[model samples]
Target chain A: MRSGYYKETIVEHINLTDSTLQRAWIGIGLLLVIAAPFHFEFYGLSLITLMMITAIGAMGLNVLTGWTGLISLGQTAFMVLGAYAYAISTESWGWPPLLGFVLAGIVPAIASVIVGVPSLRLTGLYLAITTLASAFIVNHLVLEFDGLTNGSSGIFVNRPVIFGYAFDTDAKFYYLTAGFGILTILACLNLRRSRIGRALIAIRDNDNAARVMGIDLRAYKLYAFVASSFIVGISGALYGIFLSFVTVDGFPFLLAIEALAILIVGGMGSIAGAILGAVFLVGLPEVTSFVFSWMGSSAQSLLSTSAHEIKGLLYGLIIILFLRLQPHGLMGLWQDARRTWTLWPLKY
Target chain B: MNYLAELLASGLAVGAVYGLIAMSFAIIYKSTGLLNFAQGEMGMIIAYVAWSISTSVDGNPFIVALGSIGFAVLFALAVERIVIRPMMSEPILSQIMVTIGLSVIFRSAIILIWDGLPHNMAIASGNQLVDLGGVRVRAAQIAVLVALFAAIAGMWAFFRYSRFGVAMRAVASDDATAQLMGVSSGKVQMAAWAAAAVLSGVAGVLFAIAYELSPSLYALGLKAFPATILGGLDAVIGSAVGGLIIGVTENLVGGYISSGLKEVAGFVIIILILMVRPYGLFGEKRIERL
Candidate 1:
């Protein structure tokens, strides 16, 4: 027990030092923000924008799954709520884009609290299934509320205007997404340092133990859901602004599963993991298609239709492999590599 | 009255398919304590296999049905061996994720092999309308009801009389104790998955008669999730009953109210039911050991 406690402190120390490394990451991110638009075209910028939005959503999922020990398949459902809310408030009610965005985040966060309250009593896979049901309900609600959501035709979202400055082009939107992405990262970083964050982790480690220690289970769990869903909701609103369209078809349970996959592949609790996982999972198809097209016309022709299938196969394989061999995900691998590099002279 | 009877008959028919799929879910959950998200996909894929077999045999429905179940058992055993067995010691979350990943793979594979277009499965009765006094029901619907009852009765008898079934129950209750008692937990897990696959396969074939076969048929598998959840994740009888409730609710809502409510009704019931009974109807109340 003494050794176990010592080991945990050592891990904690490593994380503290890791934050210093995160400063360097911030510098790199700023550099990318300044440099990416110049280097890449519209498609590339749009993809990066998408990746950033996904990263924010993945972070939200990480908060629930990684920190609070709650597995939610309803991340995309919250996102859809945010997206549709953004579209409706901005278009139908003639609300300002900024207010619409704020409404989007608040609405889904409240929904999350409602959904989390009753279901939090259940643990593990049961909670996961409940969340899955929530996603289905979200999809159904999108279809059923045809008057508001416009049914299958969906709604068109205009570019978000910030004090008369419009984020019209893909590059401009990429900057907006990047700004939000950085804010999400910093907010999450700050959250982890706060007492509430510590409480969340403690509950994650053992809910009953945390409860014994005088922590309110219901409040903290709802906090986690609200906080996470708030972030996911913002990402969804931005996603709508970026795409300039919203469709019921756009937010399938498949998309939710992919978000969960990002969390798992990124390293559940790590901030950097969310970004890395999102980029890798989102960019994989584009990269695969690029490589395939480069191979020759024949290969591309054969795989044109089946490219999605191949991507699914590879993604599934990666999930299984990561779970079996590297449960810490890509972020874990990065830490391991950093450790090895730091210990190079000593050679183990 | 005639419309009501027709609706009831059709609802029971579809509910039987859901029951079959839900039973598969219950069996796997009972034995392994993990829900197979890929069960529906496996069923759909196996139905396609059945379709191929039927076509090869000049449309012999019996041979196709038998072959499909056989192939499904083999596929399930392979899945258990290759993907599931290695991760036996992992967390429940990891196992669940693996199944979800497996589901994606299976869905994509079906798409790859057969493309995304729907296929017509030759129903044994060929859309024949059977007169049940004043109310007319499709022969395929009757076949589905019969198949559901047969499957349930067969499962009951197997659990009651068969040595393997008894061994499986032992393993499910306590794997370590069952292993000590000389029952191979591995084989039991395999059999449980196989039984689920066979049941799902039969459901898939019957479903194909009612609805077109397509990659999207995995959605039907997802449709069974609420059934298992509502019934009790591990109770076979409860799952069957839960399926009937969901099936009938969907039909009644679709028929009587707005048709758009059909798909959403089951989910609404699930949320409402879970709010009241978290463990679900007929589920064993878990005593948390603090």
Candidate 2:
């Protein structure tokens, strides 16, 4: 076997010993994701697509809450705004579908700035409550502007026709969402290494110290908010397209909580953790149903009827348990497992 | 004029319930420095327990109330010990998230046990209208107001004169200093949670009597945030006054403006207040050091 420290160059030393192996794993994962539709049924395929969409939003949330240390309970509000923006622009304003998607992001980003500017001064729990209030206000506005949002009855949306190619089929839509999701992941990875990203992390760790170090707290916080909401808005657009209908009820307060759960369960401040969390949480209900199907009919019936509550309870328990036991989350667990495997037959 | 008078009378009663819940929130924030997101859910669960007790005890209000308060204290103590105590050393974010987790669990558990239907409680003076100077009010409303005053008075006396209460205040200001002076911050935090639970339990039962007990009752808990924020996160009496303000404002807005605006009136007020005074009307300004 080759010795671990065989590298002569500084660049080689900086890179992981298993960098090529890691790249190969990533390649295989991508291939599997691309081939998922062929291997799985329609239901399973749709679930995977939904997971990718959720990952996009969760990643956006990670940028704010994870990286910047800002707590937002209004993420759903931005998603709602994005969904409505896409729906209204394409349906009423007669904008092109692609352009509507762009607007979807822009609208919520603007709203985020409006909300962020006033509330970014407040930190921690105070900021959290402010975001929540904004969410209520957004929901109320969506309902009040019946002329634009079509009121509580909701608005119908058609699949996008990009460059004369229609994304009509579920499989076709899966590819569209997957493309965006991969792009989001790449962007987040780059961001974590970028100067702005470092500044954000510093601010999160200690804002006063960051301020002393010449970081513009207000501008960077706004940038974090804008970047976060923009991606979430795009995801919202995808979610609206996936459902082909958008309603106020579609984005509930629970959605925000679920996003927070995704971050905590995955691993805060880790991009890959966001995706893992999305997969685990999105697939959770299906897993529960499969298990419940094996139980007695009466028990299964009871569970099915109260499935929403059961899911909520599980999410709550998971958040609490993860924080109490494994604060670093599934990513930390994965790292420990990998270390164990790499050190097989050695006590170390 | 008559309609306005009726609205004001009912608003004050509803405000009293809000005040009680706000007090509960303030109590925890004052002593522990942790905003309890599960405050409303605590009230909701206690109310449900009280309802069950009422049904089993042949609708005796006194027994139901006492049992509910006892249950609330034990439940709060258990929560403090189990969910919160372990998290005491964790970051503020973790503490907040834990309470949110507790909220989700409590809300879901309530739904799982009680179902989603609204239940009418026969514990309080049920729907008996009392005409006061041409203004019609429910007897339950009057009882809620009385409870609110009694609670505020009791809290004032306890905080002002009691030894333990002074210890809690001492811990709140400086936990380290309090520890040096022989006050156990841990015990004080536990007492704060228990006190909050009792206040929430009473408020929940009173609210259920005034309105009706339902799964949606927990939403009222969220509304109390505005009250607490308005009065000041750590101001007990200020939060009570804030609740009254929020309650009356909500009524006037609902009565005069579109009913939709009523739901968000408190939020709007708090937002404006935050812009002007981040600490709140009655809250002390906290100066941070680098």
Candidate 2, residue B209: how far the Cα is off, in Å = 0.9
A109-168: candidate 2 lDDT, tens digit per residue: 999999998887788888898899999999999999999899999999999998889999
Candidate 1 chain A, poorest ten consecutive residues by summed lDDT: A1-10
**Model 2 chain B worst lDDT window (10 residues):** B281-290
**What DockQ score does model 1 reach against the true complex?**
0.62
Off by over 4 Å in 1: A1-22, A344-348, B287-290
**TM-score of predicted structure 2:** 0.96
Q: After the best TM-score superposition of candidate 1, give how far the Cα of residue A154 lies from its true spot, in angstroms.
A: 1.3
Error at B104, model 1, angstroms: 0.9
lDDT score for residue A215 of model 1: 93
